[model samples]
Target: MDSQKKFWRSLWQLRVPNKIKHFMWKACNDALPTKENLHRRHVMDSTTCDLCREHLEDTIHALWLCKDISCVWSSLEWFHQAILVQPANFRELLARFRPCQDEYKVEIFVIAAWCVWNRRNALHFNRVVSLVTSICREAVFRASNVAGVGVIFRDNRGDPIGAMSMPVPFGQSMVEMEALACQRAVQFALEIGLTRVVVIEAFLNGSGQLASFENILGDIRFQAACFQHVEFNYISCACNSVADALAKKASSALVLQEWLEDLPDDIAPLVFREVH
Candidate 1:
């Protein structure tokens, strides 16, 4: 009981956007109006999932446990690992990501879960079911965009270890830029001997002709193998302001700039906001 209380307090204090925090709180409470809840309220005659009618559409079945959701979560490396533990509820499922020790992981997980829920609603009302890949990818994009500005490095207790800011070289496509940032982050992690990492990026949605996403993905995979474990997540440009600023610096920089155990005056506040 004490641990659960601590978990809730920690969750509320996380630096995620308030909407995401609200969604997670509601999700844990079974208050998102899933079909099962609707049925209980006499608002829905059937409790079947709108996407796959094989089972009742409870919060778990809609976002985490449905057969249709299997493909979506299976495509994500983190969730794939979490399934082995078979969390009995959403909070347990989220706790699986604590090993990453990053609030960003929570952001990604919540965004993905919300995406699944949003898609289910669309199917229920619009009678349209888009590709699950598209939905998941969209979630990744949004998660990245919301985290405005700067690449932040932190310890388990959320203390800053280091930070890097570099601009994408001129004329590089967004895909190329994202791929480059991820590569550099991986290299930095390798240098620091950090075994577990999650690389977040925001690539233009299906944009850029210079390089195929498959090729970029191949490169990311190769670098990821150098770590004990690694994950790549996508977010929107809006969420990536700090990294974007760093990339801008790189663009104008005559050479690479590195900050160790300290941050520039301008970027320090962003880090402070994220932690406190």
Candidate 2:
């Protein structure tokens, strides 16, 4: 286990440069499963998808490919070039997703997924099934015209890191943007050759008691696994503001990928764009 971890750390260090990036890769407190979680997994019921009986009613089928969803894709020509989206479960689907290097594509993918999720919720709560073509068209349009996006990450100081001021086509909830920041932070850590990290997020959904699991973070499972290593903490808005601003910076300039340098002029106008 130690050797395997070492390999991951080296990789992360190569990807990230700052202490905040390291924290994301080095401390993953969210990964720890509690008795409640372990107990629930043991009760997983049989029978595949409620909608699609053939396959397991898991994340991948519901999000990536389903009979009902195909109509949407066909109408919208979503997979125009033929890139398969086959995920066994929701986690797998997210794991398999590689954010498009193309800013436009990336924005589209994120918004599309969120839309799909929202549509699903509407179906569950309001009995509304969205038009597949509509979803696809909206996905493309929203992605391209995204006014801004948010990216969150954490630093060694147990501080939340994020951005929230890029002009995007649509609006992103603070929670959604924070999750993006966490993902990006882990990616940066991976680039600098670090394996483990602690990502501090100020999320109402987070579980934990004042700082421990089962209090603040609501999606402990996601917050934990997304990073190679991670830790979750509840932070005051005052401390979290800096990170949120950073996410806005990254989102504002979707056209440019200014990976490591002073943020480009487009992204710089927003607060907290600097990553050094």
Candidate 3:
């Protein structure tokens, strides 16, 4: 236990943010005030796990030992290895990661742990439970800041041309943003006199949005008709990382900004990866 304490104390030395370190330290010390702890202190009568409702809540159970948490861990590619080396508690879990040289993996674990805790709180207090995939994706999104939209422009021979991304405006749906991004790309193509061009977007397939689906599609089609050759292609978000990064960049924009050569240092690596 003393050795574990040393391990927990060493976590502050990591390059992670102080907020995360504080949360992790609290988790290590069993200081999160889980339902079981609160109930023991007469704060509440029930000690049920808000997510599963089948067991008493504790820091370990709420963060890691629940069935819902198991599902979340199993959803990740690293789950097999993680489970093989599973620890007895959240502190031990974090301790295992402390010696890992890979900062990115450590970041993912930290973010995922935080996500699980947040989801547990939401369910307990607000009666809200998000899907497991959404929770994991949220962790990845927050850890990687990979929530933006990125667009890569290509020439007729499918050669690399240009790429741009802007953050999605607050309160805008992804589908709405997809349509808007494609529209903007088409308008730009027309402006630059590129008569033939293709707009590839992630997650736009004319499903849902019954009322104005066609109207949106019709608008895109109308815009494409103005060009001599235009095509709309749907690709998985994984294949659209650069464009996604750009959209994330745009989400923080007060006004639309164009980047021809001076891509921001943060997103330059993603742009380079896409181009290469």
Candidate 4:
């Protein structure tokens, strides 16, 4: 019981976005709307795994043990080797990974699990099947380093309003880069006279315990106060590809670059695909 409490504490303290942490909490608690739980509640007619259709779609099967989703985990050599045991439940499955001791590994594990759930939902609801490689790639990227920051503005219909990319200074940590990105995103929203804005970030510091990024986050909060409504959303890197590309573009660009409706030719295609 003590170890389980400690696990929950560590999970809540992770630097990943709040939504992912909440998703993990729901998964561990069997509170997620997996097919088995939904069927038990009379919400779903069938409890079979939508992706694999070979087993009950409990939180454990949907996220970790599903045959269709196995490739996503096995793609990462470390995860493949770490999860040799097939645990009975979601909590036991997470315990096999020992998420509390190593923060980096835990972050990757949580993100990957969230991606699995997201992919499952997409397939089950929207009939959109995403590649396992894409899921794995997104999880790794979100947990890995931050080279730069990218901000893009769009309207309700996904029309591009504006976008910007800025390079991060040397010696800054990943969380610091994410904070800088938030600060710049808010500043850009204000510049464009957007009274209501939604900031979509691939990574965010949910826990403000790190002193290094707290000031930056504070500035973000302060600047965000300028707008009538400002909302922050956490999205997978796959959905955030344009911003990801812009951040990579920042490395070679001499100065901070901004674009209006006419984004650079390279990024325009990505946005096109994202919206359509």
The candidate maximizing TM-score is 3
Model 2 poorest 10 in a row by lDDT? 27-36
Quote each prediction's TM-score: 0.52, 0.34, 0.56, 0.52
Residue range 1-276, candidate 1, lDDT tens digits: 998887788778655678777888998888999888988999989887767778887887888999887877876687788888678877788777655754355666777887788778887788666567645544544544421123655676756676776543323334555666666777777777778877767653535453555666676678789877777677875465556556545543435677776877776676666566
lDDT of 4 by residue, 195-248 (tens): 999898854634554576667778888999998888988876657889978876
Model 1 RMSD to the real structure? 14.7
The lDDT of each candidate is 0.67, 0.45, 0.68, 0.78
Model 4: runs farther than 4 Å from truth?
99-103, 127-129, 147-276
TM-score of model number 2: 0.34
Give the Å shift of residue 47 in candidate 3.
Answer: 2.0
Quote the lDDT for 222 in model 3: 82
Q: What is the lDDT of residue 226 in candidate 2?
A: 54
| Model 4 Cα RMSD, 1 decimal | 12.4
Which residue pairs come into collision in candidate 4? none
lDDT of 3 at 114: 79
lDDT agreement of model 3 with the native: 0.68
